[model samples]
Target: MPSGRTSARRFRNHVAAMVLAVAATLVSGAPAPVAATGQVAPPATAPSPAPVYPITARIVARYPHDPGAFTEGLLWHDGALFESIGLEGRSEVRHVRLEDGQVLARAVLPADQFGEGLALWENSLVSLTWKTGLAHRWDAKTLKRTGSFRYTGEGWGLASDGKALIQSDGSATLRFRDPKSFAVQRELTVTANGRPVRNLNELEVIDGAIFANVWHRNYLVRIDPANGAVTGLMDLSALATEVAATDPEAVPNGIAWDPAKRRLFVTGKLWPTLFEIALDPAP
Candidate 1:
């Protein structure tokens, strides 16, 4: 019923509208086959990132620690603490008294070797050397050098989960090895907020979870051993600041957990004090 000119104008308008819609879609790069109602649905929302719960350290007690020792690894066994002190020429392993921080026994490493993480496997105590790819075994009771084994990379932190020996090579990946052969059994990549977490040092296995120190950082990350996801982060900024006040190089580096007492202790390289702490949910 419309006139020819009017019909032509309407057709042209329809073409123009279609072209505009296509242009808009192309410019936005949004997916569309226009909806049934001719409206584009919103783009799917991205999944939320995994949560990292913050943990606050509550000081339970404080014990004197050696300010001269560059502590790299620490662990508690029986009633005493075993520590590995680093620095190429000054590296040593010491059996320390918890009550007085007394060095009851000590074994100095080779001048060429820089000691790193320490862990106990059954009756033997195992220690790692930085850049040497060597791991040393000692009698847990006597601290006598029993033997040595070879590994592949730089050893930053080490811990034993009873069965396999877990080791970190300053990378995000943790390797689990056969206790006797030192052969790598499997590996787990540590992650925080969907990104790899590197510089993992001074490891301690607490209640089946791996607690690691990020090198030069003032916090400890609690990692899920099965999946390597960071479930909790314990901030030790105050403790680090306290130690750094006297010695700026005294960054946090040690973690020792007494399973029987359920007590957790932490210290730093060249720190004068070691703290017994309990983690509480951050406010």
Candidate 2:
């Protein structure tokens, strides 16, 4: 359940129409929203806990993963799945096998840093730290630490558009950074139903939208890059029934997409099995 959320706003939104209006406003040639006086209208206030539709995952494949793996970030590229696991002292980045879930190569972070997220560029992998204001660089092929850089705030999640990195810091904002120098290029205030959406974590960029795992909740949202609007929200509460939560750190956090095969995968920290899900295809 989501924490500190008042009970009044606890209901989920079932109507798909909530996203329709926003979609129309974002595309080119759409009419601008205006007040009766012909002035631009203000943003509407969103219901505290936005309504979300429950989406059941279709398990395409299941693999044995280490139960001790505190998965923080996950990605699939060129037939391999790379994972980043976290804890102050046990944080590491791994190159894994999807068929058997074997750790073929690994690079461990120093004891003081808590690993958070990972993103892949051309030949490099960039990893974020929880509170250290730093990001580490690694060779994607060898899992070797190549170098490091810095950011201004906490690093919660990371995704790359192949040229630049998009990052979140447990806030309603997403920052776009230059891959080479890590300098921020732009940012957006992510919103759901016109209200800020915080706790954005574990992002996957596929088919022009950013899919994010909302921390501490059973929601996964698709965000529009142009206006920072959450175009779709899916409830994954039923998935929790499959695993009994025993570890305090266990939570739904990792998300990856296989572009070639058009497969979607998800798993949580300390999860024994990884899931391959078939999402509702867009009309």
Candidate 3:
């Protein structure tokens, strides 16, 4: 059997190959797979869904200036914000004030792992590292490392369904894993307009569907949990692009929903603004 590091490298290579293949297919304009009913089928590629949100969001609050944060995961708990910021040497887990983005507490990771997704489960905080294939568990209060487990592929986004830890690895596939053992329980490929959508990142399990941020895009997709079909898309083009035009790294990545307060918060890599939004249901 290959070592954990070797396995991680192999998974990364496979994902890269898959991405290249997708790009090539799009460029060639080849006919994609069909359902075999003598009708034109949807393209195999997962293109971004058209905006369908009926209600426009009003940004309630914006946190500008935490410009060094390469934000990967964000969650709202109690009255504080729990954020997992990425980039190997600079990765950290922090507790911040929701009102002003003030860092209340923080714990830095080792200088080798680029942190990715995070979630609060039970009484501990769970996090995934992008390249290390490691899932870390930390004390929710102290931010002390309690345990670590290995996973396959590059971890991109993670959320909990109140039972299992749901994860995405920059693929069309979404995986559910046992929180304790980190063993994959089942997987589903996300489809938009009957086509598989890859690069699914920054997830939040809202209501019964999975809301994900498509990397490098200005939209959020709501996917049916049972069938992996995209039900709606929310356009956030206006929020991040204003800054993105000036900053190359201001890519939206973090998403957190406050169920109790009925609010949503989004932020990006090295961005100065954190937006508080209210998602109106699609009509």
Best by lDDT: 1
Writing each residue's lDDT as its tens digit, candidate 3 over 83-151 gives 999886999999888778899888888899988899889988999998788899999898999999998
TM values, all candidates: 0.80, 0.81, 0.81
Model 2: lDDT equals 0.76
lDDT (Cα, 0-100) at 49 in candidate 2: 33
Tens digits of lDDT, candidate 2, 206-239: 7888988876555577888999987666555556
Model 1 clashing residue pairs (backbone): none
Against the true structure, candidate 1 reaches a TM-score of 0.80
Candidate 1's C-alpha runs over 4 A off are 1-50, 245-248, 280-283
Query: With candidate 1 superimposed using the best TM-score fit, by how many Å does residue 231's alpha carbon deviate from the native?
Result: 0.6
The CA lDDT at 85 in model 1 is 94
Query: lDDT of all the models against the reference?
Result: 0.80, 0.76, 0.77
Q: For model 3, what is the alpha-carbon lDDT of residue 69?
A: 88
